[model samples]
Target chain A: MIEAHSISFRYHEAWVLQEVSFRVEKGEFVGVIGPNGSGKTTLLKLLYGLLAPQRGEILFELVPMKKMDRRDIAKRIAVVAQETQLLFPFSVLETVLMGRSPYLGRLLFESEKDLEIARKAMEWTKILPFSERPVEELSGGERKRVFIARALAQEPEVILLDEPTANLDIEHQIDFLDLILTLNRERGLTIVMASHDMNIASEFCDRLILLQEGRIYQMGTPEEVVTKENIESVYGCEVWIDQHPVSGMPRISLLRKGGR
Target chain B: MKIITLKKVLTISILLGFVLIVIILISITMGSVKVPPLRSIRILFRAILGLKGAGNETERTIILSLRLPRAILAGFVGAGLSVSGATFQALLRNPLADPYILGVSSGAAVGAIIAILLGLGVSSFGLPLVSFLGALLSIVVVFYCGRQEGRIHPHTLLLAGVIVGSFLSALIMFFISLSQKEELRTIIFWLMGDFSFSNARSILIIFPYILLGVFLLYLRARHLNLILSGEESAVQLGVDVERLKLVSYLSASLITAASVSVCGLIGFVGLIIPHSVRLIFGPDHRLLIPASALIGASFLVACDTFARTLLAPVELPVGVVTAAFGGPFFIYLLRTRKAIRTL
Candidate 1:
């Protein structure tokens, strides 16, 4: 579980996150939904210890994040950001093996145990077939899967993903989300994912945290949080909300200005 | 499944080591007077084993006094520059980065030129010391200039290096304008890169620096691999990115300074050799660094040998030979590779 108290982050004299506080319970699938510039990515980075909150502290498992060593934090938290521009050629396997870096000692190569873990991670992500191919040669969806495999190779207890399906096609979006959902359901992996797609978030997350202009607008189950008024107020857009006939979860349909 | 296994890479490295030994023997035997490769090998072996009468007195004298030290010095310089090149390229996350590209060499050159202007003897350890300071200063300047918000940008770093390099070159010219004809000739020859003045002491002076630098860089190969993935990703993977950058920059600059002090700025070896090794062996620094060092040593020894022998009595600067040979080889590489990948 992770707890952030009164967290605020400023970039270039502008506060991207202000007085934001939240808690994520162990093994919970949480989705952070926000419009553009709503500090979703910044919050995830702060939680992962990549950025320190200006006025708040983040705690992981009752310990202040500041007290934890980087390697220690890395062992427990894995992050996948929007696709990184790899200027160098690394094979898919190499990229995934980097996930084990926190576990290896200095001057040590990948031991049999490390390789085995990486192999299992690759298998979980279904990226084992292209393990020898250069990451640069992979499609965007495949590369995203590669990154997920890398995060899984860390064997971290918590996974933080920033827009993991941003550029993915519909099929790959469903595929990628299914993979994350399977990890959360079967492996009990805690996931804190930032996403712009409300339907996907509503469908997958056990709970939703809606962010508006650097503050949490609402936090609850999708039915409680994804109400029509809440969506319009946070996003400044009108929306219609109804229950999914299949899963009984809240579904949102936007009201475009032409129709409105 | 691994495309390039550790075992295969190790075997190739060992094979290259043998090839390097053979090249060293061939290089020592080559000059205005040709000594056979077998005779050269015997002389070297006997000398190493402390046995006598492997060759006549003249052959022994040539092998020991003229060729051996020079060959060793060339080997060190080549290996040092090449490994340093690999380090800079990885640290900067740009394939185009090398010591010369980063202006570290030019900075050291300024120090050497200043020492020569002050009439410091070429053999004096002061030359190497000053050069080391100069190289360190240049990297500091470039590093500072390139950094924005605690991160180094590849574009800014490359631009800063070019700017610093040109500034130092101008300073060198200003001093050249103030020098007498004899000093000018010496400075020009040094700038073009020469090993004619190499001796046993120079070899000893440069060896440890290269060895230490290469070993440290090789040890950080995994860190370098992570770094090339991008700083944020590297940090996420638990690497202390800033510390890795600082250590690699220092080690690389130290070796560049040592090599530059002993033999003036040799261009292209640093740029060409490592990139070539990367193309063949992939960008895994564990293999890339050592392979670059071995291949660089062989390449420079051969180039220096040709420099000494091609015109018979008139020796060309080895830098010229490298630029001539390396430039073409690099172009060929660019044309041949389907795509350039960063690892």
Candidate 2:
């Protein structure tokens, strides 16, 4: 489990995240939902220790993240950020093997055991067939899977994802969420995902944290947070909310002003 | 994605090592005076093994004293520059990065030109020392200028390097314009990269710097591979990204300084050899670094050979030969190879 206490982060004079505090419990899928520039991505980065909070602290299993070595932090928490530009044409296998880097020494190459773990991760992500292909040649969805496999290869207790399905088609988006859901259920991997899609988050996430302008607007079950009143107040938009017929979760639909 | 095992790396190294040795032998045999390959190899082994024999004195002298040292110096310089190039490319995550991209070569050139103008003997260590100090100074200034919020930003570093390099190059041009006829020729020859003046002592001086730099880089090869993914990801993967950048930058600059001090600016070996190696081998720095060193050594030795022998009595600068040969060949590879297009 991870805990944040009054953590704030600023990029110059503007605070990207202000007085934000939350907890991610073990084996839970927590979706962080917000509009553009709501500090979702910044919060995920702060959670993984990529950027330190300007005030307060983050703790992993009751230990302050500041006290943990980067390698130690990496071993417990993995992140699949938005697709990074691939500078080198590293093969799929090579890219996946990089996840084992936290466990490796400066001079050490991946051992047979590390390779085995990576292989299993690739298999779990259903990307084993293209293991020899360079990552640059993969489609966006396939590359996302490759990154998930890479994060899985870390064998972390928690995985942080930043708008992972933003570029995918609906089919691939559902497929990606399903993969993550399976990991949370089967492997007991705690997930803290940042997403813009409200319906998808409602159906998949155990709980939702709604952020508005660098502060948590609401944090509760999807039914409690994804109401029509909350959406209009925070997003300043007209919206209709209803239950998803299949899963019976809260569903949101945008409404034009004076139209619907 | 075949696993890069120790055995595979060693096998490739040995194969390239053989190629390097064969190229060195061929280079030694070639010159205005042609020594046969067999006799050159014999003279080389005898000299290396410290064995005395009734060999032809002129042939022995040419192979042992002049051509041999020049070829070895070329090999070291080639290896150093290419390895530095590969390291810089990885650190910056830009395929266009080469060893001289950081302004180290220009700084060294300015130092060497100043030493030449001051009448410092080429044979003395003072010239090389001053050149290395200049290179070191440029590195410090560039790094200082490139820092953002206590971290070195790649774009800022690159921009700083260009600015510093341009400033130093202007200084070099100013010095060149002010020099007299004899000093001008020496300055021009040095700028064009001459290996004719190389002796055993010069080779000895640069050998350790190049070796240490390359060895330190090789040790960081795995970390470099992780870095190619991106700095943020590298940090998440537990790499000390800042430390890696600092170490690689300094090591690559150290070798570049050592090489430019002894042989002046050799140009394309650093830029082309790493690309060629990456095209043949994969982008994995573990193999890329050593393979580039070997191929670069052979390429430079061969280029230096052509510089000395192509016109017979009239010698061309090794830089001219490298650029002329390397440019066309790299273009050919770029045109024909699909993999190279990705870079």
Chain B TM (all candidates) = 0.90, 0.95
For A23-119, candidate 2 gives per-residue lDDT tens digits of 9899999999999999999999889888899898999999999888889988989999897768877889999999998998664578899999999
Candidate 1 lDDT over residue span A1-260, tens digit each: 89999888997799999998889999999999989999999998898888888898899999999898778888999999987868767889989998999998485478778889999999999999989888999999999999999999999999999998899999999999999999999999999999999998999999999999999999999998999889988888878899988998999987788793
Per-prediction DockQ comes to: 0.61, 0.70
lDDT of 2: 0.90
**Residue A100 displacement (Å), model 1:** 1.2
DockQ of candidate 1 relative to the true structure: 0.61
Label model 2 with its docking quality class.
medium
Candidate 2 local Cα displacement, residue A121, angstroms: 0.7
lDDT of 1 by residue, B1-343 (tens): 6644567668988999898888888888888776777887888888889888487889888888788889888999999999999888888777777777778888888888888888887777767667767877998998899888887676788899899999998998898999999888878878989886456788888899899999888888888888887888988988878778877877888888889878888889998898888777788887888899999999999999899999988998899999999999988887876564433
The reply for model 2, stretches above 4 Å from the true place, is B339-343
Q: Per-residue CA lDDT of candidate 2, range B1-343, in tens?
A: 4878778889999999999999998888888987777888888888888899436999888888889889889999999999999999998888889999989989999999999899887767877778778888898899899998788888999999999999999999999999999999888888888886456788888999999999888989999988887898988888888888888888999999899988788888899998888887888888998899999999999999999999989999999999999999998886766755444
After superposing candidate 1, which stretches have Cα over 4 Å from the reference?
A258-260, B3-9, B121-126, B143-160, B338-343
